[model samples]
Target: MYKTKRTVFIFLILLISLIVLTACNKASSSSGDEETSKEDTKEASTEPVELTIAARAGSMADALTEVVKQYEEETGNKVNVNAMPYDNLKETVVLDVRNNSGAFDLVMIDDPWMPEFAEGELLTNLDSYFPDGLASDFVQKSAALGKVPYETGSTYAVPFIGNVQMFFYRNDLVEKYDIDAPQTWDDVLAFAETIKDEEQETFGYALRGQRGNPIVSNYLPLFWAYGGTVLDENMKPQVNTEAGVKAMEMYMKLKETGPKGVETFDSDQIATSLTQGQVAMTIAWPSWVSEVDNKENSNVVGKVNFSAVPSQESDAAAMIGNWLLGIPRTSQNTDAAAAFLEWVTSAETQKEMTILGAGAPTRVSVYEDPELVEQYRHFPAQLEALQNSVARPRTSKWSQVEDTWGMYLSQILAGQLDIQEGLDKANEELEGILAK
Candidate 1:
C-alpha cells in the first residue's frame, strides 16, 4: 500500500511538472498550501513536481530538515526546504499567497495567521483532502487553531510547532533583592520600581520596544491583565476604552526597566538584553532557555528560572506560538500530503523532535516524556502556559489590525504619540478595517 501511494505521488508530481509555471528559484513557504490536484494511473505522463517546504531557521529548521530528509529517502520524491529568517517568514508566506504565487507547496504558518489564510481561501482545506478523515492524534489546542468555527468545519492547517511565551527571571536576583515573583501587573510595576531603587544596573524587566509583532505581543498579557481586549466575544474592535487605557499606562511603566533603545528592539534585542543580564526579568519563548544557559553567550549561566508569564488582574496570559500545516487547493497530490502529514505528526516523531529540542509537541503525552522533561526543566510550566495562552483575534482583518496596532505601538513607545492617542488611532483603524 505504501509503495503504491509513493508511486502514485511520484507520478502526480511528474504530471504537474510538465505545466511548468516559471523559473523555480525555489523558496519554501510557511503554511501556505498551494492549489493541489489528483489524477489516476492512466493520466500519468508529466514530469514530477518538486515540493518546497518552508519554515524558520534555527534549531527548529534543523530538526525539520532531519525529518524531511527521512521522508525524501523513504519515497523517491525530492522535498526542498527553505529555512527563512524568523522575521521574513511572516511576510514571505502572506505576500506569496495573496498573489496566488504557489511558490510553496507546504508552508509552516503561525497559528494566529491561520485565520487570515483560511478566511481568504488562500490555503487548502484539510477535511476534503485527507482521505482517511482528519487524524485524531493531533493535540487539541493546536488543532483548534486551524478549525473553522461552525459545524466541525474543514481545518485549514495542522499544528506542527507548539510554542508559548514563558517568563524567565534570575532566581538569585529575586532572592537577593527580596523581591517576590511577580503575581500580576500591579506586582510587576511594584517590582520594577523596587529594582530601580535597589539595582540601578538591572531593571525589573525587559519589554520588547520594537514595533510590529514584538511590541504588540509584549503588551497582550498586560492588556488582558487589565481586562482590556482588542475585540469582544462578537469580534468587534474595542481597544480604545477604559481597560485599554489602563493597560497602555502600565505598559509604559515597563519601559523604565527595559533597554535604552527598546523602541527599536525586536526579539533578538529583548532576548539579548534579558539573558545577558541587562534586566532582572522578561517574558520570552522556551527557546530562550538554551540561549540563557549557553555560557558562551550568557554571563548569567545557570541562574535563570522559567515559569508562566506572571499575571495580576488576570491569570497568566501566554501567547500561543503554534505553526500549522495543511494541503493546498492547488495541490496535484492530496494523498501524498495526507500520508506525509500523518507520518510527520505521529507520536513517535513528536517525541523524537521534542527530545532533540527541535519542535515541541502539542500532544500532552510528549510533555511528560521523561527525556524531554529532563532536558527542558520547565516543560510543565510551558504546558500550563500553552493551556492558558491567548490567541490573537481571528478575523480576516487581523493583518491590517496588526499593522495599525504595530505602527501605533512604535509611535507610543517612541513617545511620538501619547498612549491614548496612539491606541485611539489604532482602534479607529481597526474598526475601519473590520467595517471594510
Candidate 2:
C-alpha cells in the first residue's frame, strides 16, 4: 500500500509539470505573433522620410501649415515649411531652383511665374503622373493657368487658390438708397456719386491707389471692361489707345470719389474700409471676402454683398490671381512631394480646408458643395466670376511689364504725371520689353 501511494504521487507531479511547460510555450508564441503584427503596422504607417516646402507667408502660409500637419499625422513623415515673405518668395525660389540648392522639394508659385519656370525647365512635368489628366472638378480657368502654354500644354503646377476679383458692396446701404445693383462701370460711377451725395460721405469708393502691383491689379478690370488692352494680339503695347485713355479717365473719375490718402491704400486698407462699413462699394478678391463675415476682424458681417465685377461695353472679366504648387526638377523627394501635392489639391482636402476657413477652393465640386455655398453666400458669384476670368498675359516678362506699367499708373493716380504722358511712356516701355 505504501509503494502504490508513492507511485501515484510521482505520476501526479509529472502531469502537473507537463501542463505548466505547455502553457508557457503557448503564451510565448502568442506574444511573438503580437510583436510581429505591431512591427508590420509600424512599418506600414510610417514612411521615415522628410520633405521641405517653400510656402508664402500670411494666411495662405498658415493654411498650408495646417494641411502639412494632417499629412504628417497620417504618414509619420517629417515636414519642414519655409514661409517666406510674399515679396521675397519669388526671387528666393528662383535662386534656389536655378542653383539646384535642393533647399525646397516643393514650392508655391504665383500663376504668372509659371511661364518663366516652365521655359527654364525648372519644374517637374506632372503629365506622366496624371496620365488621365487633372481632375475634372478643377475650375477650367484656374487650372488652365497651371499649364505652360496658358490654356494648354503639359501640366506643371496645380492651382491652390481660386482667386478672382469681385465686387463688394454694403447691402444695407444699397437698400437704404433704393439703388439697383450696378451692371456697368458707368453704373458704378453713378452709384458712387449717389452714395457720396445722399450719404454726405467723404468717399463713396475704396481704391488701391498704391504704386506697383496693388494699383495695377485694381485698374486692370476697368481697363479690360472699357474695351482697352495692355497689349494687342501681336504682343505690342496698346496702353495709349483711345480706349486706354477712356479707361484711365474713368479710373481717375472714380478716384475722385475715394477717401483722402487713397494713394497709399493697399489691399489691407481696402479690406479694412469695407469691413468697417466705411466704404459704399469696392472691387475686391476672394482673399478679402473671408474677412467680411468674421466678427473678430469685421464690423460688416452679413451686411456686405458680393457680385461678379461690373462691366461696361465689354463683358465683366475678373483677373485670375491663383497660387500654384509645383515640384522642383532637382527635388530628391519627388514621389513624396507629388503625393503631398495631389493630396492637398484633392476635393476632399479643399473642402476640409474651407471648413477651417483657409482659402478659396480651386475645385468646382467644393465651390458647389451645398454646405459650403450655404455658409459662404458669395460662392455662386465667386464661381461665376472665376469662370469669366482672364489671366495675366502669359509672358515671362510680365513682372517687368507690370513694374514699368504700374509705375506709370501710380504716377498718373498721384497727379505727378499727366495721364496721356504716363500712358505713352508705359506704352513705349512695354514695346521695348516685348521687343526683347
Candidate 3:
C-alpha cells in the first residue's frame, strides 16, 4: 500500500511541472507580441512630422503652445510655431502656400483674407477634418466669419481671435481737461487739433502710419463715419465718391495732429505712446489696449477708459479685424490640427483664454461672463458694436485692394499727393482690379 501511494505522488508532481512550463511559455509569447505592437505604433509615429504654424502678432501663439504641448505629451507628436509679425504675413503666406513647399502646415490669417484663400482652395476645408463640426456651438456672426459667404458651405477656418476697433481715452486726462467724451467725429477732430496746438510736446493722437494693414485700419473708421463704404452693395469701388473724399480728407486732418514720426507708427508705437500718456484719445484695438491695461508695463492703469468710436453718421465705425485659424491643404496632420481648433474655440477653453488675454471669446455665453463684465466695463458697448460690426467686403480681391488703397493713403498722408488726387489714383488702380 505504501509503494502504490508513492507512485501516485510522483506522477502528480510530473504532471504539475509540465503544466507550469507550458503556462510560462504562453505568457512569454504574449508579452513579446505586445512589445512588438507597441514598437510598430511608435515607429509609425516616428516619421518626424513638424507642424509649422505661421501666424501674425497676438497672444495666440502662447495660448496655442500650452495646448500643443499637452497634445504632444499624449501623442508624441511635434509642433513648431512661427510667429510672423503682421506686416510680413500677407506677402510671405501667399508665396509659401502657392509653392506647395509643405513649409506651413497651419496658418493664422486676418478674416478679410479668407475669401481669397478659400476661393483659391489654398486652405483645406475644415469640414472633412473636424469631428464635432460647426453645428450650433458657435455664435452665428462668428460662425459666418469662417464660412464661404452666400453659399451653403463648410468651415474654411476657425475664428481664434475676435478683434474689433475700440475708442480709448484717459478718464483722468479728460476730467482734468474739463472735456466730455467726444460724442461726434467732428468733436474728435477738434479735440485732436486742440491737443496738437496747445499741448505742444504731446501729440493730439498717435495714429498708425505704416502702410498696408496699419494705414487701412486707421482710415476705415473715418470712412465709415463719412458714410463711405469700401465696396458698395454691388461690390463696386465707391471709395472716391463725395463720402469717400470726405473720409480721405478726415484722414489728412488726422495726420495734421499726429506725432512727429507718425509715418513710422505701428501697434508697438501706438500702444506705448498711449500708455505713456502722450495720447489723449485714439481709436485702438483690443489687442493694443490690453497692453496698456496690463499692470506690469502700463503707466495709465486705472486711468484709461474705453468708449465706442465717435459717430460720423451714427457712431464711430470701427473696423472689425478677426484672426482665424485654418489647416493648409498640404498638412499631413489635418485631424490633429482640426481637433486643436475645435477645443480652443470651445466655451470652456475660451474663458481660460480670456483670463490669459489670448483674445476675445467668440461665444455669447463667455462674452457675458460676470467676471469679464467687472473687468471690462465697456462690455455692454462692445457687445452692441459687435452685433452691428462691419466686416470688410467679402471678396477675393481684398488683398489687392488693401495694397492699392493703403499705398494711396500713405502718399496722401505724406503730402506727396492731395486727398482728391490720391483717391483718383486709388480709383484708377481699383477700377483695373475690378476689371481683372
User: Which of the numbered candidates is closest to the native, going by highest TM-score?
Assistant: 2
Residue-level lDDT tens digits of model 2 in 110-174: 89899899888889999988888789999999889888777878899999988788999888887
lDDT of 3 by residue, 1-436 (tens): 9999999999999999999999999999999999999999888756545577887765777776656676577556677778878889866777777887667777888888888887778888877765556756455566678887622578888877777778887677567678888877788788788877877656777778788778888888888887888887777787788887887777768778877788778888888889887887777877665677788888888887777677786455667777888888877777767666676677777777777767566677777889888876666556555655677888988878988988988888888888888888898889889778
Clashes of 1: 21
> Sorted on TM-score, highest at the top, how do the candidates line up?
2, 1, 3
Residue-by-residue lDDT tens digits, candidate 1, 1-436: 9999999999999878864533242322221223122343423523344677668787877787777777777775667778999789878877776776767777787777676677667777677656554565555666778777522566777778788888887888778877777777777778777777788678777888777778888888878777777898777788888877888888888887666877888888877877678787788888888888887889788788888887766677878888777665555555666667777777788877776667478777788788778878878888788877787887767767877888897898789998889888998888788887
Residue 17, model 3, lDDT: 100
Question: How do all models score by TM-score?
Answer: 0.81, 0.86, 0.76
lDDT of 3 at 245: 84
Ranking by lDDT: 2, 3, 1
- In terms of lDDT, the best-performing candidate is 2
Model 1 TM: 0.81
For residue 103, model 2's alpha carbon misses the true position, in angstroms, by 2.2
Reference-based lDDT, residue 296, model 2: 93
